[model samples]
Target: MGTLKAWMDYLNSINGKEHDSFFKPYKEGKWSKAAIISHMMFWDRFFYEERLPHMLKGETLVGITAEQVEEMNKKAEEYAHSGITLQEIIDEALKYRQMLLDKLQDEDLSRTFTIKDRKISLQEYVNGEIEHDEHHLKQLKAK
Candidate 1:
């Protein structure tokens, strides 16, 4: 479940669903599928474009505050509602994820990187993304 191939297969399984199914919130105060897609899309690009390259170069990542996280969530919600189709977001997210997998294809998962001086392996980071996606999947599937 930690491998890139596993993650891609999981994504492909769900990515072909109807767009309208992803447009509306499942319940009050919960995120719509569109917002979830937007959130994943944002993080996929962030990982591929910012974090992974820096990790490969052994550069430090400045700590992101709780407020910054809140802001990103707000931005994702706005993006989801700004008339962009859910399919577009899904496509871009998957593309970035593929880029990430490609970039890390021959890299050592056990190799460590520092984020705010705290060290972690690439496997740990990828697992975090899987956990995040699974959490949202559960929310979306809940009755």
Candidate 2:
């Protein structure tokens, strides 16, 4: 299966137990799995709404800075506890994923965005998403 297909299938299989368990951090002050998931969803929404439009318009893209990434994590964690249920997160994640997937034409995958002064292709970015998903999924299930 495609990376997104497999990754999203794993997400679709998450139950209440998994969702609740995801909130358990391996160490204090670290991100819980749900927070990580929320962060991913935020970016998925980001590209779905922001990056895709720029690419579609053939506009230049901007790179995300470390400060911005930190802030995004903070925002995601805040939202995770802001009364949005895990189910809601999952639902929104699916929608965001679909939004991007719908635009993933071969031409779209060839699109590039400027990040860190480098041109990053949509295909490269999507691969990074899979890598992110795998990293977090392992941490989430680690004993």
Maximum-lDDT candidate: 1
Candidate 1's error at 66, in angstroms? 0.9
Q: In candidate 1, which residue ranges exceed 4 Å CA deviation?
A: 1-7, 14-17
Kindly report which residue pairs in candidate 2 clash with one another.
none
Instruction: Name the TM-score of candidate 1.
Output: 0.86
Worst 10 residues of 1 by lDDT: 1-10
lDDT of 1 at 26: 67
Q: Kindly state the number of residue pairs that clash in model 1.
A: 0
Candidate 2 lDDT over 1-143, as tens digits, reads 14876657767777444456666665677777777778878988887787777866656778778998889889998887787788888877778887777777545576777765677787887888778777776766666
